[model samples]
Target: MSAGLLILFYLGLSLGPLILAWAQELDPRTPWDELATGLGFLALAIILVEFLLLGRFRLVTGRVGSDVVMRSHQLLARAALVLAVLHPFFYISPRTPAPAWDVTRQSVVDQSWHALWPGIVAWLLLGGLVAMALAKEVSGLRYQHWRLLHGLGAAVIAGFGVLHALRAGRYSADPALAAVWLALLALALGALAYVYLIAPLLRLRRPWRVREVRHEADRTWVLTLTPDFRGRLPYRAGQFAWLNVGKPVVSLDENPFSIASAPSAGPEIEFLIKEQGDSTCRTGQIAPGTRAWLEAPHGHLIIDKHPDAAGIALVAGGVGLAPLMGILRELHATGDQRPTALIYGNRHAGQIAYGPELERLAREHGTELVHVLSEPPPGWTGETGLITPDLLRRHFGPPDRHGWLYVLCGPPPMLTMVEDTLIDMGIPAHRILSEQFVYD
Candidate 1:
């Protein structure tokens, strides 16, 4: 589907609950009371939608890049947390027994312990959940442990929030609204089940095996995987997959890595992995032929999406060159004669991966390869500084180059600098594609 259609679908899912509640035509309460209920309804809806925005759904992330989808998930979670936190405080009505005339609790909040307990539990847990998420990096939690906690916590919050809505909410007592809540809750839970259970079960049928693990650069390894089954791993050049080596299909030990091998280069997928966390730092120890599992082909960095572009400009930093290498190799293999340029920046020459192939691309395929080093070697002849605005302007300043498709993968700071410079140089935002290596 198109971007516009995806946006329309999202807006519809988010606003549909509010519209249904308004259609109930119940007696109106004070503005504050209505505002409180409105915020609760909206927050619940947003929380439910957060499941799909976890960047695992291809239907959602395929059109917009996973980086954009994951970023949206983070922002929307915070937004829902704020709305949920303030929802109870907005009620002006007293928490007391409803008068005979207000049988539906239209003018009073439900004070019964049964109705309020779920809401109280959900409310407090929501705060803690958001807090833990915001502090994930500094919380000293392992990535897999944090992921499991995050998923289970979200599921509990959704369950309790729905229960509270059904029992304590005045509008939620309506059958249509109650059905909406149930459906939303089911979907939220279903998303969890799909990610944790169903997807892994399917992956069991088409497992991969570790074919090789060769050290590519300083503290980096080129890990190759070949399918244990029949066909090749179908993926775009610039996409990535969650790889689990020597682990069960349902294990959370997997980490995402960009595909460094070209799709045209056959089924054996390759990943240039840099030593980072516990799982990645031990890539060298993973024996060949170890059973591996891959959640294949996720990302929108592929060049095929922008065939109208006059040229391709790939900007990569350090090991972020993995995906760009795939794109370059595919272009070269397919004999795509689009004018291509690569601006690769690293701390030193030793940090560059696939250096010989990159040089070959420049010599044989007419790719304008510019190597920028922050700490160059003693006898380096290339640029020796950060990839700055001046560097971009020197290479892509011409009027015709503005139409080129610029794909960037790098650390956050370099991405920000290059993206800002590109926009300042009159490159349209739609023409520039980028994915940050680190989401956290």
Candidate 2:
């Protein structure tokens, strides 16, 4: 789907509730009461739609990159929290049941303790959920444990929010509005079920086995995996997968890593992983033949979609080179004649992965390879310091700006700086694809 269409679809879903409620044409309440109702409807809709954003649905993430999807999920969650918190405060109406003289209840908001409890619970839990997400990095919770808690907490909040709307909302008495609320709730919970349960059940039939784990660069390892079955994963170059090495099929222990091996390179897959803390501490030490499961082929960093581009510029930082390697390999395997350049950045020479293979690509495929090191050793001939605008200007000048696709992967700071530089060079935003390391 196109970006415009995807955005319109989202706005339609999130705002549809308020539009429908306004169509009810009941007696208008005080401005503050109506404002409260409208905000509540928007909050509920936004919260419900968040499920699809993180649901790993290709239709959503395919057009928008996974990083975009994740960032949207985080930003929208905060907005929903703000709207939800302020939902009740704007009501100027009395707290009373619908009186016989006022069937529309325009003068009173739902005041029954039983009906109000759900909203109270949801309001408090929503605050906690957002706080947990904001503090995810410093929470001292394992990624998997944090993921489980996040998922369960979101599900509970959605249920309570929908219940409160149905039982207490003035416009919700309209069957149309109530049905939309229930349907949205079903989709929200159903998405959660599919991610945690249905997807795992399906994965059970297609397991993978760890083939090898070889040290690649400083503190980085190249882990190879081959499917235990006959079929290979249908994935595009520059995409990633969730790896669950030595973990259960339904386990949340899986971590996402960009696929380092091209789909053209047989059935085996490889991941260039940096040894971070926690589960990744065992990354370089995993024994071969370990049982593994992969929830794969996510991310929209693929280059094939831009066949019309004049050239390709791949920018990488450290292990971020993994996905770009997949793209370059696929191009080489397919004998793509388009001119391509790779600007790989790292802190030091030892941090660079796939040095020999990249050189081979430069020799055989005519790929322009440039390495940038922050802490270069003596007599270094390549660019020194971080990837600078001057460096990008020399490479992606206006002369080659016929929408040459620039794909980037790295730490958030590097991606941001490089992306801003690219746009400053008059490269249309659509021409760039990026996926950053999501610390959450």
Which candidate's TM-score is highest? Answer: 1
Model 1, 226-294: lDDT tens digits are 999999888999999988899888887888899999999998999999999899999999999999999
What TM-score would every model get versus the actual structure? 0.98, 0.97
List candidate 1 stretches off by more than 4 Å. none
What would the TM-score be for candidate 2 when compared with the true structure? 0.97
Candidate 2: global Cα-lDDT?
0.90
Residues 165-258, model 2: lDDT tens digits = 9888889989999999999999999999998889988999999999999999899999999999989999999999988999889888888899
lDDT by candidate, in order shown:
0.91, 0.90
Model 2 ranges off by over 4 Å: 401-403
